[model samples]
Target chain A: MSSERSARSRHRAILVLTGLGLAAAAILATLDHFTHEPIALERERRALAALTAVLPADSFDNELVTDFIEIGIDGLAMPARIYRARLAGQPVAAVYDVTTDRGYSGSIRLLAAIDPDATLIAVRVLEHRETPGLGDRIEVERSNWIRQFSGRSLDDPPRQRWAPDRRDGDFDTLSNATITAGAVIEAVRRNLEHFEVLGESVWSDPEDTEHD
Target chain B: MKPEHQDIWRQGLWQANPGLVQLLGLCPLLAVSTSTINGLALGLATIAVLVCSNAAVSVLRGQLRPEIRIPAFVIIIATTVTVVDLTLQAWFHDLSRALGIFVPLIVTNCTILARAEAFASRQPLVPAIHDGLAQGTGFAAVLIVLGASRELFGHGTLLADADRLFGPAAADWTIQLLPESWEMLLAILPPGAFIALGLLVALRQWLIGQTGALRARAGQSEAAA
Candidate 1:
C-alpha cells in the first residue's frame, strides 16, 4: 500500500519479466544452433539429388567439373557456363552450359545432358519464373517441353544441331509455348556442343597421364 | 480473456486461415502441393514451431523491455524454428528436404509473428500455448486440405506419397480414383492452388454458415418456447 512497497512490486515485475525474456531467448538460440546444419545440409542434399538425377554423382568421384567454360548462345547474345560430365577418366556425358535468355518470359537456366553417344540424358531447369499455368509449362511438373530434348543431337557436331520442331523440324514444341520451346531447344543445342568441344578436358579424370 | 482465446482457435481455422484467408504462404503451398504428403509435412512442421515459440513468448511477455521486444521475439522465433527444423532433418530427412526453405522461412512467416506480437506478448504461458496449438492446428488443417485437394485431382488419387508424410503404414493409404491417364492439367498448377484455395475458403464459409444458422434457429425456438 505504501510508496516503498509499490516501488518494490514494480521492480519485482521487471525482474520476473527479464528472467522470462532471457529464458525464451536461450531456448530459441539452442534450437537454432542444433538445426542450422541439418537445414542447410537438407537443401544441399536435395540440390545434389537433382544434380545427380541429371548428372550421375556415383560415376565420378570428383563430383564436379572445375573447368567453367563459356559459350556464345545461339538465341541469346550471352555466353553461359559449359560443364563436362566425366566418369573415372573418360567422358561419359556432355553437360551443356545451357540458358534460355529469350523466352516469352524471363531468362531460363538449364543443364541439358547428352551422353558420349549424344543421347539426351536429362534436362534440368536451373531457374525460371514463367506464368505458373501457361508459360511455366517449361517446368518438369507441367508440360513435357523438357523431356522432348532427351534423344536430340547436333548433326553439325556441336556447332549447329537439329531444328526445333516449332521452326518446322523434328522436335515438338509445346502447343502454345513456341518461344519457350525454341529457347530450350537452343540452350540444349549449345549445351551439347560445349560437351563435344570440352569433353576431353571436362570429362577426363585429372589423374589420367595422356593429357600430359 | 476466455472468449478472446476461443476466438484465436476459431480465427485460425476459418476467419483467418494463414494460407487461404490471409494469403501468407502462397509460395510453398503452390510449389510443393504435388501430393497430400507434401502438404501434411509442411503443416506439421509449422505446428511444432508455432507451439514452441508462442509458449516461450507468452512465458516471457513481462520481462522483455519495450525497446527491444521485437528483436527478442525474432530471436526466440528463429531459435524455436531452428530446433524444429533440425529435429525434422535428423528424424525426417526426406520431409525436411521436401519442405525446404519454407521451414526456416517460418521464422519470417507473418502468421507466427503476428501471433507472437499480438497474443503471446500480452498473454500468460498457458493461454499462449493454447493459442499456439489452436492456431498451428488450424493452419495445418488448411494446408493439408488445400494440399489434399490438389494431390487428389492432380494425380488421380489422394495421399500419393502417404509413406513420406505419414510413415510407411500410410503407403497403402493412397486412393486411386481416376484412370492413370486422366490428368487435370489445371488442377496441379499454381493457378490450381489458387482455384483450390478459393473453393476451399468458400466451402469452409458454407459449412460455418450452416452451423451458425442451425444454432440461431435452435436459440430462437428455445426463446419462443
Candidate 2:
C-alpha cells in the first residue's frame, strides 16, 4: 500500500511539472507572436536599406518589393530571390539574393546587383559566418574589399581575373583568409554570370506567371 | 536586508563568482567578448533571464519533486531565455543581429541552472532575487572587462560601434587610440579570450592570498601583544 502510494505521488509530480512546462511555453509563444511583427518590420526596413545602398538614387522609382522574381539556379545553395528595379517602367537593374556554401564556416549570403548592360553594379555580404578579423573583411563596414566589385563586369577584368591574385587573378585575398576570399569572389562572379545568362528572364514581371 | 542575504551577495559577486570563480557559461563568455557592446548586450540579456528564472524556481520550490527537479529547472531556464531572446530581437534588432547564435544558446548556460538549483530552490523569494542579481552582475563585470581588453588590443579602439548598444546618437562615440594600420589579430580570436580570462583569475587569486596573509599577520601580532 505504501509503495503504491509513493508511485502515484511520483507520477503526479511528473504530470504537474509537465503541465507547468507547457504553460510556460504557451505563454512565451503568445509573447513571441506579439513581438514578431516589429521584428519583421525591422527586417524589411534593413532589406530596403541594403537594396538602396547597392543601387544608385536616380535609377529606380518603383517599389522593388513588388517587382521581384524567384528562381533556383545552379551553383547557389538555395533558390535565389531577385528584386528588380524599374526606371520609367523599364528594367534598370536586377538584385539577386544568392547564397554560397563555399564560406569557411557555413553559408555566406550575398546581394548582387547587375545593371541592364549585364555589368555588375555592386555586391554586398548580407550575412556570413566567417571569422571576424579574418574573413569578415568581406563586409563593407569591415573593409573596402567588397566595394571593388562595383564597377567591374564579367569581361572588364576578364573571366580569368575573377580569382584572387594569389590564385593568379586580379582580385586580392585577405591576409589570413584566402579560402573565404576565394569563395566570395567565386560566388560573386558566378552570380554575375548567372544574371548574364538569364538576361531579361531574371527580372520577369510579377503579374505575368505563377512561378510560385 | 539581512546579514545572511549580504553574505549571499558577496559569495555570488566575488567569492563564488559565476564567471571568474565558478567559471560557468564560458561558451558565450569567450565567443561574444570580442566587443564591449556585444558583451554588455549579452550580459544584460543573461541578467534578465537569470532574475526571472531564479524567481520562478523559488516560487515553485515547494512543489517540485527532487527526482524531476533538474528537468523542471531546465524548462524554466529555457523558457526564460527564449522570452529574453525574443524580446531582444523585437526591441534591439541590431544588437540581436550582432549577438547572433549566442542569445538562444543562453539556454545551455549552466550558470542559470546552477543558481536555480544551488540557491533559488532552497532560498526565500527575496534572497533568490538577491543571488540572481549578484551573480548576474559578476558575470556582466567579467564580460565587460574581457570585452574591453580584447577590443582595445584587437582593433585599438574603445567602445567601437557604441551605437549598437546605445542608439543613433552614439555613432561617433568610438575613440580610435591607434593608427588605422594597427591591429592585433590574436587578441580578437579564441586564444586571446582564454589568456585574458586566465590572467584575471590569477590576479584575483593573488589578491585574495595577499589579504589573507595580512589578516593572519595582524592576528599573530595581537596575540603576541
Candidate 3:
C-alpha cells in the first residue's frame, strides 16, 4: 500500500513539474510576441544611427541605410556591407562596415566612410572586445584616438606609413594599446585601398552585381 | 511593517546580504560591475526577476511537492529572467546592449534560486515579496559602490556613460573625478573586482564586530546599575 502511494506521489510530481514548464513557456511566448517588433526597430535604429554618424547628414540626400551593397574584401574577416551616400544623383561617399579579428582580445568591427576622392570622411568603432581602460580608447565616446583617421587617404599616408607610430608609421597609437590601434589603422587602410580598387563602380545599384 | 516583515528586511539587507554576506550571484556581480551604469542596469533587471520569481514560488508553494520543487522553481526563475531580458531589449535598447549576455545570464545568478528554495518556498506571498525587495536592494547597493569605485579609480570618472542607463538627458551626467590622462588600469580589470569585494566584505564584518562589542559593553553597564 505504501509503495503504491509512493508511485502515485511520483506521478503527481511529474505532472506538476510539466505543468509549470508549460506555463513558463506560455509566458515567454507572449512576451516575445509583443517585444519582437520593437526589438527589430531598435536594432534598425542603432544601425541607421551608426551609418549616419560616419556619413555627413548634409552631404547625403539618399537614404544611406537602404542604399548599401555587399562585397568581399581581402582584409575583412567576412563579406562587408558598403553603404553609398549621394547628393542628388552624384555619389558623395561610401561607408564600409568592416570587421577585423586582429584585436588583442577578439573581433573589432568598424565603420569607415570614404569620400569620392578616396579621402576618409570618418571612422567609428561599432563593436570591439578589447580591454576597457586600455584598448577601448578607440571608441569616440572614450577618446579622440579614432578621429585622427579623418581626411587621411592611402596616398597621403604613403601606403606604408598608414600604421601606428609605434610600428614606425605616421598615425599615433593609444597609450598601452598598440595592438588595438594597429588593427583599426590597418582595417581603415585596407578599406581605403579596396575603395580605390572599386572606384566609381561602387556607386552602382546593389542588385546589379550579377552584371559585373 | 509587521515584526516578521521587519525581520525579513533585516536579514535580506544586512544579516544575509546576497553580495557581501551570502556571496551569491558573484559572477554577474563581478563581470557587469565594470561601470556604475552597467551595474545599475543589471541590478534593476535582477530586482525585477527576483521579485517575480519569489512571488511565484511563494504562490505555488502549496502545490509544489518536495521531489519536483527544484524543477518548478527553475522554470519560474528562467521564465521571469527571459521576460526581463526581452523587455530590456525592446524598451531600454541601449542599456540592454551595454549589459549584453549578463542580462540573459540572470537565470543562473544562484541568489534567485537560493531565495526561491530557502525563503520563498516556505514563506507567504507578502514576506517573500519583501525578502526579494530587500535582498535585491542590498545587492544593487554593493554593485553601485563597487562600480563607482572602479570607474573613479580605473577610468577617472563616475557614471561615465550615464546616457546608456538613464537615456539621453543624462548624457552630461558623467562626473570626471580624475583628469583624462590619469588612469589606474588595474582597478578596471578583473582583479580589481576581487579586491573591491574583499574590502567591502571586510568592512561589513568589522562593523558587525564593533556593534557586537558596543552592545555587550552596554549590557554589562546596565547589569551593574
TM-score of chain B of each: 0.85, 0.91, 0.92
Q: Candidate 1 residues B49-141, lDDT tens each?
A: 889889888777776656557877787887777777778876687666567677887776777887888778888887888778887877778
* RMSD of every prediction: 6.5, 4.2, 4.2
lDDT by residue (B1-225, candidate 3, tens digit) is 333877677667777788997899999999889999888888888999999999999999998998888889888988998999999999988888889899889998999999999889998899899989988988898899999888888888888889988879999998988897778888889999999999999987778678976556434533432
Estimate the TM-score for candidate 2.
0.92
Q: Write the per-residue lDDT of candidate 1 for residues A1-212, one digit (tens) a residue.
A: 69998777778766655765677668756876776786777666765665666776776554554543455645654666545546665666656655666777688877776777766788877667554345567778556667766666676334343556657666776765677777777767766655555545554444552532
Model 2, total clashes: 0
Per-prediction share of native contacts kept: 0.32, 0.68, 0.97
Q: Taking the tens digit of each residue's C-alpha lDDT, what string does model 2 give over A50-140?
A: 8888997778999986677777767888678889898988888898888999999899998998888988899899999998778999999
Model 1 / residue B93 / CA error / Å: 4.8
TM-score of each: 0.69, 0.92, 0.92
TM-score of 1: 0.69
How many clashing pairs per prediction, in order? 6, 0, 0
Spell out the clash pairs found in candidate 2.
Answer: none
DockQ list for all candidates: 0.26, 0.71, 0.77
- Ranking of candidates on TM-score, top first: 2, 3, 1
Q: Please state the error at residue A134 of candidate 1 in Å.
A: 7.7
In model 3 chain A, the worst 10-residue window by lDDT is A203-212
